[model samples]
Target: MADDQLGEEYTCRVCGFRYDTPTWDGGSGSHDICLCCGTQFGYQDTVLDGVWSVRAKWAAEGHQWSSPEFRPPDWEPGTQLAQVPDRWADASVLAFKLSAPPLPAMRTSADPEAQRAEVLGRFLRDGRLTHFPATGREWTIVLEHIAAGFEPGVKYRRLEIDKLLKAWHGKPADLLSRLTDQGFVANDDQYYWRAER
Candidate 1:
Protein backbone atom coordinates (compact mmCIF):
# COMPACT_ATOMS: atom_id res chain seq x y z
CA MET A 1 0.00 0.00 0.00
CA ALA A 2 1.05 3.60 -0.52
CA ASP A 3 2.11 5.90 2.37
CA ASP A 4 -1.09 7.94 1.90
CA GLN A 5 -3.10 4.85 2.76
CA LEU A 6 -1.85 5.23 6.32
CA GLY A 7 -3.94 7.71 8.26
CA GLU A 8 -2.47 10.71 10.02
CA GLU A 9 -0.88 10.17 13.43
CA TYR A 10 -2.16 12.39 16.23
CA THR A 11 -0.05 13.46 19.19
CA CYS A 12 -1.17 13.21 22.79
CA ARG A 13 -1.36 16.70 24.29
CA VAL A 14 -0.26 15.47 27.69
CA CYS A 15 2.69 13.21 26.90
CA GLY A 16 3.35 13.80 23.22
CA PHE A 17 2.75 10.17 22.23
CA ARG A 18 1.67 9.75 18.62
CA TYR A 19 -1.25 7.41 18.18
CA ASP A 20 -2.90 6.15 15.02
CA THR A 21 -6.33 7.14 16.24
CA PRO A 22 -7.65 10.59 17.00
CA THR A 23 -7.96 11.43 20.69
CA TRP A 24 -9.52 14.81 20.09
CA ASP A 25 -11.50 15.72 17.01
CA GLY A 26 -13.29 18.85 15.84
CA GLY A 27 -13.53 20.41 19.32
CA SER A 28 -14.81 17.14 20.72
CA GLY A 29 -12.81 14.42 22.43
CA SER A 30 -12.65 10.94 20.93
CA HIS A 31 -12.26 9.66 24.50
CA ASP A 32 -9.37 7.44 23.37
CA ILE A 33 -7.06 7.06 26.34
CA CYS A 34 -3.33 7.55 25.79
CA LEU A 35 -1.23 4.44 26.37
CA CYS A 36 1.67 6.57 27.50
CA CYS A 37 0.21 9.08 29.99
CA GLY A 38 -3.20 7.51 30.61
CA THR A 39 -5.04 10.68 29.51
CA GLN A 40 -8.62 9.94 28.56
CA PHE A 41 -9.35 12.63 25.97
CA GLY A 42 -13.03 13.26 26.61
CA TYR A 43 -12.77 12.58 30.31
CA GLN A 44 -9.60 13.71 32.05
CA ASP A 45 -8.36 15.95 29.26
CA THR A 46 -11.46 17.89 28.35
CA VAL A 47 -9.59 21.08 29.08
CA LEU A 48 -5.95 22.12 28.70
CA ASP A 49 -5.62 22.65 32.46
CA GLY A 50 -6.86 19.15 33.10
CA VAL A 51 -4.39 17.78 30.57
CA TRP A 52 -1.50 19.48 32.36
CA SER A 53 -2.79 18.25 35.69
CA VAL A 54 -2.64 14.70 34.42
CA ARG A 55 0.81 15.27 32.94
CA ALA A 56 2.07 16.63 36.26
CA LYS A 57 0.80 13.57 38.10
CA TRP A 58 2.30 11.29 35.48
CA ALA A 59 5.67 13.01 35.76
CA ALA A 60 5.58 12.73 39.53
CA GLU A 61 5.13 9.00 39.11
CA GLY A 62 8.45 8.71 37.22
CA HIS A 63 7.08 9.12 33.67
CA GLN A 64 6.29 5.45 33.36
CA TRP A 65 4.33 4.24 30.38
CA SER A 66 0.69 3.96 31.49
CA SER A 67 0.19 0.85 29.41
CA PRO A 68 3.30 -1.26 29.69
CA GLU A 69 1.72 -4.02 27.63
CA PHE A 70 1.31 -1.63 24.69
CA ARG A 71 4.74 -0.04 25.08
CA PRO A 72 7.46 -1.18 22.75
CA PRO A 73 10.44 -2.92 24.29
CA ASP A 74 12.67 -0.03 23.15
CA TRP A 75 10.30 2.76 24.13
CA GLU A 76 12.17 5.85 25.31
CA PRO A 77 10.25 8.46 27.34
CA GLY A 78 12.55 11.34 26.44
CA THR A 79 12.31 10.70 22.73
CA GLN A 80 8.53 10.48 22.86
CA LEU A 81 8.14 13.71 24.82
CA ALA A 82 10.08 15.65 22.21
CA GLN A 83 7.08 15.47 19.89
CA VAL A 84 4.93 17.72 22.11
CA PRO A 85 3.76 20.80 20.21
CA ASP A 86 5.47 24.06 21.12
CA ARG A 87 2.14 25.55 22.22
CA TRP A 88 1.82 22.80 24.80
CA ALA A 89 5.48 22.17 25.55
CA ASP A 90 5.72 21.88 29.32
CA ALA A 91 8.82 23.02 31.13
CA SER A 92 8.07 20.47 33.83
CA VAL A 93 8.66 17.71 31.31
CA LEU A 94 12.24 18.88 30.93
CA ALA A 95 13.05 17.59 34.42
CA PHE A 96 13.02 14.19 32.79
CA LYS A 97 16.05 12.91 30.84
CA LEU A 98 14.54 13.81 27.46
CA SER A 99 15.53 17.49 27.55
CA ALA A 100 18.00 18.82 25.02
CA PRO A 101 21.65 18.26 25.76
CA PRO A 102 23.39 21.01 27.73
CA LEU A 103 25.10 23.66 25.68
CA PRO A 104 28.90 23.81 25.77
CA ALA A 105 30.24 26.06 28.51
CA MET A 106 31.71 29.49 27.70
CA ARG A 107 28.89 31.46 26.11
CA THR A 108 31.33 33.61 24.13
CA SER A 109 33.06 30.60 22.61
CA ALA A 110 29.87 28.63 21.89
CA ASP A 111 27.43 30.26 19.47
CA PRO A 112 23.97 28.99 20.39
CA GLU A 113 22.29 30.99 17.62
CA ALA A 114 24.53 29.35 15.00
CA GLN A 115 23.70 25.92 16.38
CA ARG A 116 20.00 26.70 16.17
CA ALA A 117 20.41 28.04 12.62
CA GLU A 118 22.07 24.76 11.62
CA VAL A 119 19.10 22.82 12.95
CA LEU A 120 16.62 25.23 11.36
CA GLY A 121 18.39 24.87 8.00
CA ARG A 122 17.14 21.31 7.78
CA PHE A 123 13.56 22.59 7.39
CA LEU A 124 14.49 24.61 4.29
CA ARG A 125 14.63 23.32 0.72
CA ASP A 126 17.08 25.10 -1.61
CA GLY A 127 16.82 28.37 0.38
CA ARG A 128 13.00 28.29 0.49
CA LEU A 129 11.08 27.46 3.65
CA THR A 130 9.73 23.91 3.56
CA HIS A 131 7.64 24.66 6.67
CA PHE A 132 7.69 26.98 9.64
CA PRO A 133 9.35 25.92 12.87
CA ALA A 134 7.27 25.69 16.05
CA THR A 135 9.50 27.72 18.35
CA GLY A 136 9.23 31.50 18.00
CA ARG A 137 12.99 32.10 17.81
CA GLU A 138 13.48 29.57 15.03
CA TRP A 139 10.45 30.92 13.22
CA THR A 140 11.83 34.43 13.52
CA ILE A 141 15.17 33.31 12.10
CA VAL A 142 13.43 31.89 9.05
CA LEU A 143 11.42 35.09 8.53
CA GLU A 144 14.58 37.16 8.94
CA HIS A 145 16.36 35.08 6.33
CA ILE A 146 13.53 35.52 3.86
CA ALA A 147 13.20 39.23 4.62
CA ALA A 148 16.93 39.67 3.89
CA GLY A 149 16.24 39.24 0.18
CA PHE A 150 14.69 42.72 0.05
CA GLU A 151 17.14 45.56 -0.31
CA PRO A 152 17.15 48.00 2.59
CA GLY A 153 15.83 51.58 1.98
CA VAL A 154 14.05 50.46 -1.22
CA LYS A 155 10.26 50.78 -1.22
CA TYR A 156 8.29 48.03 -2.94
CA ARG A 157 4.70 47.99 -4.12
CA ARG A 158 2.38 45.36 -2.62
CA LEU A 159 2.57 43.35 -5.84
CA GLU A 160 6.35 43.42 -5.76
CA ILE A 161 6.42 42.30 -2.15
CA ASP A 162 4.05 39.49 -2.98
CA LYS A 163 6.21 38.36 -5.87
CA LEU A 164 9.37 38.48 -3.78
CA LEU A 165 7.84 36.52 -0.90
CA LYS A 166 6.32 33.96 -3.29
CA ALA A 167 9.83 32.99 -4.32
CA TRP A 168 10.44 31.88 -0.72
CA HIS A 169 7.01 30.45 0.16
CA GLY A 170 4.05 29.24 -1.86
CA LYS A 171 1.70 31.28 0.35
CA PRO A 172 3.31 34.62 1.04
CA ALA A 173 0.50 36.63 2.62
CA ASP A 174 0.91 35.22 6.12
CA LEU A 175 4.71 35.31 5.83
CA LEU A 176 4.51 38.93 4.69
CA SER A 177 2.18 39.78 7.54
CA ARG A 178 4.57 38.29 10.05
CA LEU A 179 7.54 40.08 8.48
CA THR A 180 5.85 43.46 8.84
CA ASP A 181 4.31 42.60 12.22
CA GLN A 182 7.69 41.63 13.60
CA GLY A 183 9.35 44.83 12.34
CA PHE A 184 11.53 43.05 9.77
CA VAL A 185 9.73 45.21 7.23
CA ALA A 186 7.99 48.55 7.52
CA ASN A 187 4.98 49.40 5.41
CA ASP A 188 2.24 51.91 4.77
CA ASP A 189 -0.99 51.26 2.88
CA GLN A 190 0.61 51.11 -0.57
CA TYR A 191 4.33 50.42 -0.02
CA TYR A 192 6.70 48.24 2.03
CA TRP A 193 10.41 48.36 2.71
CA ARG A 194 12.93 46.35 4.72
CA ALA A 195 13.18 47.87 8.20
CA GLU A 196 16.48 49.55 8.97
CA ARG A 197 18.76 47.25 10.98
Candidate 2:
Protein backbone atom coordinates (compact mmCIF):
# COMPACT_ATOMS: atom_id res chain seq x y z
CA MET A 1 0.00 0.00 0.00
CA ALA A 2 1.07 3.60 -0.65
CA ASP A 3 2.35 5.65 2.32
CA ASP A 4 -0.38 8.31 2.02
CA GLN A 5 -3.09 5.65 1.91
CA LEU A 6 -1.58 3.96 4.96
CA GLY A 7 -1.80 7.05 7.21
CA GLU A 8 -4.74 8.84 5.56
CA GLU A 9 -7.28 8.58 8.35
CA TYR A 10 -7.36 9.29 12.07
CA THR A 11 -10.40 9.28 14.37
CA CYS A 12 -10.63 10.85 17.80
CA ARG A 13 -11.89 8.23 20.21
CA VAL A 14 -12.97 10.84 22.74
CA CYS A 15 -14.96 13.21 20.46
CA GLY A 16 -15.65 11.19 17.26
CA PHE A 17 -14.06 13.77 14.94
CA ARG A 18 -13.52 12.61 11.33
CA TYR A 19 -11.78 14.28 8.38
CA ASP A 20 -11.27 13.43 4.70
CA THR A 21 -8.04 11.91 3.31
CA PRO A 22 -6.69 15.24 1.95
CA THR A 23 -7.05 18.30 4.14
CA TRP A 24 -7.11 21.86 2.73
CA ASP A 25 -3.77 22.60 4.42
CA GLY A 26 -2.26 19.70 2.42
CA GLY A 27 -1.55 17.81 5.62
CA SER A 28 0.12 14.56 4.56
CA GLY A 29 -2.63 12.49 6.18
CA SER A 30 -6.08 13.26 7.53
CA HIS A 31 -6.70 12.80 11.23
CA ASP A 32 -9.66 11.02 12.83
CA ILE A 33 -11.04 13.91 14.90
CA CYS A 34 -11.97 17.57 14.83
CA LEU A 35 -8.78 19.44 15.76
CA CYS A 36 -10.63 21.68 18.24
CA CYS A 37 -12.52 18.98 20.20
CA GLY A 38 -11.58 15.42 21.13
CA THR A 39 -14.72 14.22 19.27
CA GLN A 40 -14.68 12.81 15.74
CA PHE A 41 -16.26 15.22 13.26
CA GLY A 42 -16.32 15.22 9.42
CA TYR A 43 -14.03 18.27 8.85
CA GLN A 44 -10.62 19.78 9.47
CA ASP A 45 -9.75 22.65 11.81
CA THR A 46 -7.11 25.42 11.80
CA VAL A 47 -5.65 24.08 15.05
CA LEU A 48 -5.34 20.37 15.95
CA ASP A 49 -4.68 19.58 19.60
CA GLY A 50 -3.85 15.94 18.92
CA VAL A 51 -1.39 16.84 16.15
CA TRP A 52 0.15 19.56 18.31
CA SER A 53 0.49 17.14 21.21
CA VAL A 54 2.23 14.56 19.01
CA ARG A 55 4.59 17.24 17.65
CA ALA A 56 5.39 18.46 21.16
CA LYS A 57 6.12 14.90 22.29
CA TRP A 58 8.44 14.35 19.32
CA ALA A 59 10.31 17.56 20.07
CA ALA A 60 10.61 16.60 23.74
CA GLU A 61 12.11 13.26 22.66
CA GLY A 62 14.71 15.01 20.42
CA HIS A 63 13.14 13.85 17.16
CA GLN A 64 11.92 15.62 14.06
CA TRP A 65 9.12 14.47 11.84
CA SER A 66 10.04 13.31 8.36
CA SER A 67 9.14 15.68 5.53
CA PRO A 68 10.17 16.08 1.92
CA GLU A 69 10.94 19.76 2.62
CA PHE A 70 12.48 20.22 6.03
CA ARG A 71 11.90 23.51 7.83
CA PRO A 72 10.68 24.69 11.20
CA PRO A 73 6.89 24.34 10.92
CA ASP A 74 5.99 27.81 12.20
CA TRP A 75 9.10 29.73 11.16
CA GLU A 76 8.73 32.29 8.39
CA PRO A 77 11.18 33.21 5.66
CA GLY A 78 13.67 36.10 6.27
CA THR A 79 13.67 35.59 10.04
CA GLN A 80 17.29 35.56 11.13
CA LEU A 81 18.30 32.60 13.29
CA ALA A 82 19.59 33.35 16.76
CA GLN A 83 23.34 33.16 17.21
CA VAL A 84 24.60 30.58 19.69
CA PRO A 85 27.22 31.78 22.16
CA ASP A 86 30.68 30.26 21.56
CA ARG A 87 30.76 28.65 25.01
CA TRP A 88 27.26 27.21 24.62
CA ALA A 89 28.03 25.87 21.16
CA ASP A 90 31.24 24.30 22.42
CA ALA A 91 29.38 22.71 25.31
CA SER A 92 27.17 20.68 22.98
CA VAL A 93 30.07 18.32 22.21
CA LEU A 94 30.49 17.72 25.93
CA ALA A 95 26.87 16.60 26.33
CA PHE A 96 27.79 12.98 25.50
CA LYS A 97 29.39 12.71 28.94
CA LEU A 98 25.93 13.03 30.45
CA SER A 99 24.69 9.84 28.77
CA ALA A 100 24.53 6.44 30.45
CA PRO A 101 26.94 3.82 29.08
CA PRO A 102 25.80 0.66 27.23
CA LEU A 103 26.43 -2.48 29.28
CA PRO A 104 25.36 -6.10 29.29
CA ALA A 105 22.12 -7.15 30.98
CA MET A 106 22.70 -6.90 34.73
CA ARG A 107 20.59 -6.08 37.74
CA THR A 108 21.07 -2.55 39.06
CA SER A 109 20.21 -1.55 42.60
CA ALA A 110 19.72 1.55 44.66
CA ASP A 111 22.63 0.35 46.80
CA PRO A 112 25.87 1.81 45.41
CA GLU A 113 27.95 -1.33 46.08
CA ALA A 114 25.63 -3.62 44.14
CA GLN A 115 25.56 -1.23 41.21
CA ARG A 116 29.36 -1.15 41.24
CA ALA A 117 29.64 -4.92 41.13
CA GLU A 118 27.16 -5.15 38.25
CA VAL A 119 29.05 -2.57 36.21
CA LEU A 120 32.42 -4.16 36.95
CA GLY A 121 31.22 -7.55 35.80
CA ARG A 122 30.04 -6.01 32.51
CA PHE A 123 33.40 -4.27 32.11
CA LEU A 124 35.40 -7.47 32.66
CA ARG A 125 33.28 -9.24 30.07
CA ASP A 126 33.52 -6.60 27.32
CA GLY A 127 36.78 -4.79 28.09
CA ARG A 128 40.41 -5.91 27.94
CA LEU A 129 42.94 -4.04 30.09
CA THR A 130 46.57 -4.99 29.56
CA HIS A 131 47.85 -3.56 32.80
CA PHE A 132 46.23 -4.37 36.14
CA PRO A 133 47.90 -2.32 38.85
CA ALA A 134 47.58 -3.16 42.56
CA THR A 135 46.81 -0.84 45.52
CA GLY A 136 43.99 1.29 44.07
CA ARG A 137 42.57 4.06 46.24
CA GLU A 138 39.59 4.87 44.03
CA TRP A 139 38.40 3.56 40.69
CA THR A 140 38.83 7.08 39.35
CA ILE A 141 42.57 6.43 39.47
CA VAL A 142 42.15 3.57 37.04
CA LEU A 143 39.96 5.55 34.66
CA GLU A 144 42.30 8.53 34.74
CA HIS A 145 45.29 6.28 34.19
CA ILE A 146 43.55 4.73 31.17
CA ALA A 147 42.47 8.10 29.84
CA ALA A 148 45.98 9.56 30.15
CA GLY A 149 47.31 7.82 27.05
CA PHE A 150 44.88 9.35 24.53
CA GLU A 151 45.49 12.80 23.06
CA PRO A 152 42.76 15.50 23.19
CA GLY A 153 40.29 15.85 20.26
CA VAL A 154 41.45 12.59 18.74
CA LYS A 155 38.08 10.78 18.80
CA TYR A 156 36.05 8.87 21.42
CA ARG A 157 38.59 9.44 24.21
CA ARG A 158 37.11 12.59 25.72
CA LEU A 159 38.73 12.01 29.13
CA GLU A 160 35.67 13.56 30.78
CA ILE A 161 34.63 10.24 32.35
CA ASP A 162 36.83 10.97 35.36
CA LYS A 163 35.31 14.44 35.71
CA LEU A 164 31.82 12.99 35.30
CA LEU A 165 32.46 10.43 38.07
CA LYS A 166 33.94 12.99 40.48
CA ALA A 167 30.55 13.71 42.04
CA TRP A 168 29.95 9.98 42.76
CA HIS A 169 33.07 8.84 44.61
CA GLY A 170 31.51 5.64 45.85
CA LYS A 171 30.29 4.78 42.35
CA PRO A 172 33.42 5.52 40.33
CA ALA A 173 34.01 1.85 39.71
CA ASP A 174 30.50 1.49 38.35
CA LEU A 175 31.00 4.44 36.06
CA LEU A 176 34.40 3.18 34.91
CA SER A 177 33.08 -0.28 34.25
CA ARG A 178 30.21 1.15 32.25
CA LEU A 179 32.59 3.22 30.12
CA THR A 180 34.88 0.26 29.47
CA ASP A 181 31.98 -2.05 28.73
CA GLN A 182 30.69 0.50 26.24
CA GLY A 183 33.96 0.12 24.30
CA PHE A 184 35.09 3.69 24.72
CA VAL A 185 38.70 2.60 24.98
CA ALA A 186 41.02 -0.38 24.51
CA ASN A 187 44.10 -1.00 26.63
CA ASP A 188 47.09 -2.71 24.93
CA ASP A 189 50.21 -3.41 26.90
CA GLN A 190 49.85 -0.33 29.20
CA TYR A 191 48.80 1.93 26.32
CA TYR A 192 45.16 2.95 25.74
CA TRP A 193 43.50 3.65 22.40
CA ARG A 194 40.10 5.17 21.82
CA ALA A 195 37.67 2.51 20.60
CA GLU A 196 35.27 3.72 17.96
CA ARG A 197 32.35 1.62 16.82
TM-scores, each model vs. reference: 0.50, 0.18
With candidate 2 superimposed using the best TM-score fit, by how many Å does residue 5's alpha carbon deviate from the native?
35
lDDT of 2 by residue, 1-197 (tens): 64213323332221112222322224432222223232222332224544344433433544432221223344321110011111211232134324423212212267767655544443333244422221121233445534545564444323454544444343545545654764655554334355553
Given candidate 1, what's the lDDT at residue 87? 49
lDDT of each: 0.68, 0.35
The most accurate candidate by lDDT is 1
Candidate 1 C-alpha lDDT tens digits along 1-197: 53312222366777777654465666776555576787776688656677678878887898886655456666666666666555455776544425544212211215877756664565588878786543345556787777788998899999999998988888889889889877899998889999976
At residue 1, give the lDDT of candidate 2: 68
TM-score of predicted model 2?
A: 0.18
Off by over 4 Å in 1: 1-13, 16-75, 78-109
Question: Candidate 2: deviation at residue 85, Å?
Answer: 52
Error of 2 at 153 (Å): 7.5
- Best-fitting candidate, scored by TM-score: 1
